[model samples]
Target: MVSRRVRDIEYAIRDIAVIADQVKKKGKKVYHLNIGDPLKYDFKTPKFISEALASASHSGKNFYADSLGVYELREEISKFLKHKDNLDITSDNIVVTMGVTEAIYFLLAAMIEKGEELLIPGPTYPLYINNTKFYDGVPIEYELNEQDDWEPNLDDLRNKITDKTQAILICSPNNPTGVLFNEKKVKKIIDLAGEYNLPVLSDEIYDQITYERNYVSPASLSKDVPVIGMNGFSKAHLMTGWRLGYIYYHDPENKLLDLKEGIAKLARARLSASSIAQYAAIEIFKTKSNHTVEMVRKLRERRDYSYKRLRQIEGINCVNASGAFYLFPKLDLSGLKKWKNDKEFAIDLLKKTGVCSVYGSGFGKYGEDHIRLTFLPELSILEEVYNHIEDFVR
Candidate 1:
């Protein structure tokens, strides 16, 4: 009887080891800008994906391989999304899970129904609010405006739909505000989920981790809306522990074939997701290299040097993140009057400046006074994590 929803998703990163044990009891040098594992951030993985996983582990092609995966990696994910997003995809609307975090927990346990409702927006990506409360559903949210850059209000997603909502999650170049939605505001949230017929779940695992805008896929702005579209090879092929991931589906006449057969019976009960990492995701999707275009030009030069040292630190503000490798900011804490909110100003700035980052109120409820920061580290450790967060916020 130990599933109090997997013990509240195992205390969701419990303030990352209580801020890495208060920055190792104050010896400092912490700097881990709170999680998004690009192989712990110096990003390595392509040597043709470790030589096609050492030639499919000596060419035996290991055991389990067809739980909707490895049909030539879903025919190389339908020729890598019809040569990268010219989409009208195939390979039976793909599935191949075990990464876009189990293709977003088997597309929210195959299109969320138990007590339904999903919505999503406010500082999203806490695993889509812990897989919509571990599949019992009901996670709603809808705020985004950090002064119109974190964009997505569509009348607060059409007044948080009803008739038990069911779906509408998004995550553009967005996971803690890397804000990229504008393709005419993603065709007006795919015509407001095709006028509330609902079904969107679009994570796009940081679509090639963008920078100066252009990573669209809300199923290429609506084949009349029903888009599951998750993606992976974890952040454009750094292959986050090569768990591999995929989940496309434009709308097989929309009932979603019993939600793609409950994600192919939970991808044949998790029986596949590593067939030598799908034969090393077919040599990292046919050698599309330049290592994610030099890791998105060094994450747009660490999002322009941490958005110019978080706008010269006076009551921080940020939002210039035109792609992933997060930023979020927004920290006045009004003269730090012995803080009480943004998770006690990020656990008192990780007990005064070891700088571990993460409390955008754990990515929901309109990120109470913000803090997500992950400039993926190194530009001299993000210029000493911006001079220890501007000398612990002055």
Candidate 2:
């Protein structure tokens, strides 16, 4: 029998793809805009990074790596953080994971006791909520004001904190919404965590994929708060399938020794991330590459075009995304009375128009009446997707 915990976990982002496949078998074309995979679009990984992986495999570097990570790769990551965010992280403080997904799992597994609460943003990436439930922990959601460009509501966040709260999670260049939390908001969250003596888990996988100026990492701004910053090459380097990511713990006062040790224990149990990928990731920090710059430029064009198109639609409205590649547009269902909710509308749209998008309610309650779409497709494809959506809505 499956455990109740396993049965209770829900991943809405990929769940709709099952229905999409059934549609495809019936001779319909499906434009996959549901997932945040850059490779599905025009993005490509850098050749140097791929060549490094090939060379490492050819040269017998396939042995099991250190549980924490390949030391050289960890060192390179430390240096990259220093250069990019002015963070003084060390190799010893980093743990390599299969991806940011694993990093989140390890962090939650190590920190969350049964019934403890994790304060997360509503309409968040589903992983945080799912992982919390997997450990029998409670997920407390704070609001993200759509009227304020998806900025987190600090007052709502403060009200949600209780003695049972274990930690706080922040996803800058956030998934589903593509909203980047500014420096002021980041600092306020850190302050709240510090006051409550809770650690902060920062997901920065899309840090380099921003359309605007570079974002400030919360760890860099933190003085005494314990921060666990998670990042990987999946989004920025166009290496989602490679499954290489790392988490760095920063505690200036050494207060989080127990939490750090817990993460290390979990890392050892997993053995290590991909050895070949680690060696290749080392090459990523060593070489100067323009792949990310070019990728962001293309994404910016798509984002602008799609945002403009969505706004023109009579019943659709969305805030312009400043970072990442998603736009969560609110749908006015009054005009089209056939659908009951966003999910129903999304599935019907898929059947009728062949555009696959995840409904907003799947993210959280605040996500109701909205649908999340990736602007990752090229301009021409996006034009077609929008035309179909506009027609479907009308």
Candidate 3:
């Protein structure tokens, strides 16, 4: 029998990838808009960062780094956050993990006790919910305001609070939805955290991938609340395979000392992250500016074109994402009595039109009638995928 801890865990994003693999085995070409791996779509990591990795690997700098991270990477990360978000923290406050995925696991395990609650946004990244369940913690999802371009509903959020709630989890320029949490909602979230004396675990993994709105870290805006900031080089730097991510503790009232200690203890048990990747990260922070700007520009163009095309389709409702590389379109399946849910819609579309996507239910119940597709592909490929999806839906 499988352990209960391992049951009920599902990643719909990659689950469809498994189907795509099977389809490819039959010599069929599948157009993937499913996963967010940029490298799979011709977005190469910049040469300078790769050169740093090469140098480190050859120079015998490949030994185990500090448990949290190498000094150079940590120091660069501190300076990088200071420059990017104006969020002040030293290297000591940071703990490096395999990726934001691991950082999320560590944070959930450290903060949530058995049967305790961690508040998360509905239609979130999904990893938060899975990790909470794995750690024997309950996840309480407050809805993101889909009616208002997927903004945060503070009243709904406040009503969801309970004595069991430990921390509030957030994702800005969010996944699945492809929208930022609004400023007013951001202020209210921080205020509630302060009032409840709870920690705010903010995932800023896509902080630099904005199109219209300026990116601001939730940790930068909080006054005295403990902001457990999670970020990484995966999205912004095209270092998905590098598997380097970090978490920082902003325990202004010295309230998070024990939690920080617990995180570091876990870090020590795991030992160091990839030493070569750490060295590469040092250079990545140094060389991130131009590459990021160009990438964002390209992504914005793709976002605009894809949104326009999706909007033109009948029975499709989209929020027109302002940031990130996803287009989450709500399909009007009222007339299609054959399809029962988002997953059925997505799977049938794949079998018929060879366009791959993840269903909205995979994210959470909030996205039940929707499906998320990435615009990370080249403009031509995106145009083709959109055409195929539109024709199939019609």
Separately for all candidates shown, the number of backbone clashes (residues 3 or more apart, or on different chains) is: 0, 0, 0
Give the number of the best model, judged by lDDT. Answer: 2
Writing each residue's lDDT as its tens digit, candidate 1 over 1-394 gives 7887877773324556576776787687666788877678787877778888888989988878888888877887898788878887788889787888888877778778778888888877787778888978888899889888889888888888888988888888888888888888778877887787787878888888887767877786777667888888877778787678888888845657777887788788877777887887877666646888898898788889889988998878887888888888887777656676777777677767777788888887788788888888779888987888788778
Q: Where does the lowest 10-residue lDDT sum fall in candidate 2?
A: 208-217
TM-scores for the candidates: 0.35, 0.99, 0.98
Candidate 1 Cα RMSD (Å): 17.9
Clash count, predicted structure 2 = 0
Tens digits of per-residue lDDT, candidate 2, 238-340, equal 9999998989988899988888888898988888899999998999888988999899888899999999999999988899898988999998888768899
lDDT of 1 at 44: 82
Candidate topping TM-score:
2
Q: Compose the digit string of candidate 3's lDDT tens values, residues 264-291.
A: 9999998888999988788876663588
Ranked by TM-score, top first: 2, 3, 1
lDDT of 1 at 244: 80
lDDT (0 to 1) per candidate: 0.80, 0.91, 0.88
